[model samples]
Target: MKTPPPSELVAEWPLPPLASLGSTVRAIGIQRELRRHLPWKMRGFLRVDGNQAVLHLPIEEKEAFSAASAKIATAIEEISAYPVLPSEVEDILGISSRERHKWMKQSRLKSAGTRTVKMRGRAKAVTFHVFDAQHIEDILDRDLPTIWRQEDAAMSAENRKRAAAKRRQTRTQARSQSGCAGSADDASGSKLEGWDVFAAEGLLRAPRK
Candidate 1:
């Protein structure tokens, strides 16, 4: 039996009207603020510039987007349909290269592949990775800074504990060696002791002549 091919979605472009684009941009902003509790189809989502927003919509819906509500749907449709790029993710996340690399190493952000581009005057090309928008969005929703800070605090505490333990061990060794000395004059007498014993763990204070 010949298996049929999967059907493609054939919806026409829904270019939103000037007013609708504004609504849609506003809607996207609102949903982001409200943590997406409200549906994106609510009113006034687009930015103040309807011209740019309108371009995001299908050609058909451009004229009919009069009511604020209708435009909200168009805006939602645009975001759902648009191909988000890596640059867009960087802008939306407000992260620098160091932070981005940190996330990539930690597995918070995933890349499709490594990209290489040559500069006009460069001897060699530069290679970099591209990330998916959905993965970036997941980071935003999870509030990565919160997790990063918590992990840092825990690590700092552990380091401090280890440092204190090392200090205590050094102090104990010094006290044991000093109590074993029969006299302060023994410092000059122990020719063999100088060859053994741990390296001075702390600074040695000399006597004033």
Candidate 2:
């Protein structure tokens, strides 16, 4: 068998520190975005090792490597400041979509801006709110999710109590009205029965001789 030549194309770059940010999902997002700039054949060439992103290609594909490298470098520079997508924010904060929307709408989780992107293989565009990365970091650092959950629980308990009290009040009022009606009926019946007996004994007439 003929000896194979050694490969001459290899490029390695460190992923942006903010890319991982203690969240595996965020790191995956970063990788996906970087891959978008690569050709289909080069897509599988990318790999993440610890903090570094490595790319390997055949020597004959040097041009593809250069383009991919440049794009990766640019992404590293800009990705740190990029507004966090909703899914990314949810993963970073360990919150659900409903919670994220609630917090954002209430101004607890501030929105950096809106992002409009066309869905892949679809003609229609979709828009969504994006959040500042630093703001999310601050929120995570402060452990806001736990605090907000506690607050929500307390509010829910208070609401339940109020509802129960209102229901009790309604029942009490209904019973009171029913009891009054029953008492009126009893009094009316007693009065009619007494008058009937008096008439039968001829009490309304003069004493018989």
Candidate 3:
């Protein structure tokens, strides 16, 4: 059998604004997405430039490489325009799930829609809210997450203050009621003592004092 020349092929695509979106975490996510479409052995060999994902393979495997390249292109297009998933939103915004839920419910983070996807090995499908990419970008540019967190902390402090004030007022009212009851009991006892004294002095007809 004749030996064939060792042939290699390479392809790359820029990640554009995505590269600037979520920092290192986002890049790792993009790399994972790319690797998901590749073979396990090929996954570990994948390379990512600053904002570009590159794939290298043997020319003999051109067909597979082409297919993977096409998928990558499609992924890039979709990621560029697609609404942000909840996880992606958290990464890009640097917010926690609790904070995301709070902001979403408060209308601080608007929802573009919902996404339903079945687990790879499960029959059940999960649905979650998706956010507008542009809107998220705007929030990021404005550093809104930090602002919101600060606002939340301030509000929490205010709530604690109000709760403490309410408890103090309740205690004060309880003490006032207790004092009034004590005074009433003292008055009643004094009246009884006075009556006893009068009866003893008059009714008993005291002899020589």
Candidate 4:
């Protein structure tokens, strides 16, 4: 016997501009949030399509799909409140990992909070900072990363110059001290040689001379 085709239910939610900040990572994050409203088995049925979250389910489960879709719709309305992940920020801002770490350390990249996720197969978990979506969007619109990169470069150059000057000053001081010590040693040796010569010439007293 041949199997019959099952009817399917389809729905899609257009993601807001802030939902992803134009970053694919951000879009996927929103997609995952929508999936959370569905059963674990049905979660995989929801996926990100460009700037939208699309859901596909068999018509036989229309009730479950409708309930889940309502929750997901509500979630979409509040998607702007979602915290932007570290990777999403990197993508949205077009920054490298080093730049992200440096800026974050200096408080240039403000963190919303920290997130901890367990590895798929490892026993240990990884923790990282997450950023506010609005904050990130503001930064992107202002092209702040370019400005930040310039500032960081300038600061690094200044630090290098200061370090070099300090090293030079230390070397100069070392040389000055070494020269003084050598002069003192030379003076002491001269006195000892004179005494030895005088004693050899007259074991008694050369004080009269």
- Mind giving the per-residue lDDT tens digits that candidate 1 earns over 1-209? 99875342112234333212233433344344322322355322333233333213233443433343354444555454333334545555665667667767877667767668798999999887865445555666687756875896898899999999999999999998887775665766866555443346423446556
Q: What TM value does model 4 have?
A: 0.79
- For model 2, the stretches where C-alpha displacement exceeds 4 angstroms are 1-6, 120-124, 193-209
lDDT of every predicted structure (CA atoms): 0.52, 0.84, 0.81, 0.88
Give the better candidate number (3 or 4) by lDDT.
4
Order the candidates by lDDT, highest first. Answer: 4, 2, 3, 1
Q: For candidate 2, lDDT tens digit of each residue in 1-209?
A: 98888686777887665666677777777777778878787788887666777788889888877888898777778777867889989999999999998988778999998999999998899999988888889999899999999998999999999999999999999999999999999998778657888898888999878
Please, what are the lDDT tens digits per residue for candidate 4 over residues 17-122? 7888888888877888878877899999899888888888888988988987898888889988889888888999999999999889889899999989898988
In model 2, which residue pairs have backbone atoms overlapping below 3 Å? none
**Candidate 1 vs candidate 3: which has greater TM-score?**
3
Cα-based RMSD of candidate 2: 4.6
- In the range 42-134, model 3's lDDT, one tens digit per residue, is 776566667888888888888887887787777776656656777888888888999999999999999998989898988899999987778
TM-score-wise, the better of 3 and 4 is: 4
Question: Residue 54 of model 1: what lDDT?
Answer: 23
Looking at candidate 4, the ten consecutive residues that score lowest on lDDT are: 200-209
Which candidate gets the maximum TM-score versus the true structure? 4
In candidate 3, which residue pairs get closer than 3 Å at backbone N, Cα or C atoms, i.e. clash?
none
lDDT of 4 at 154: 100
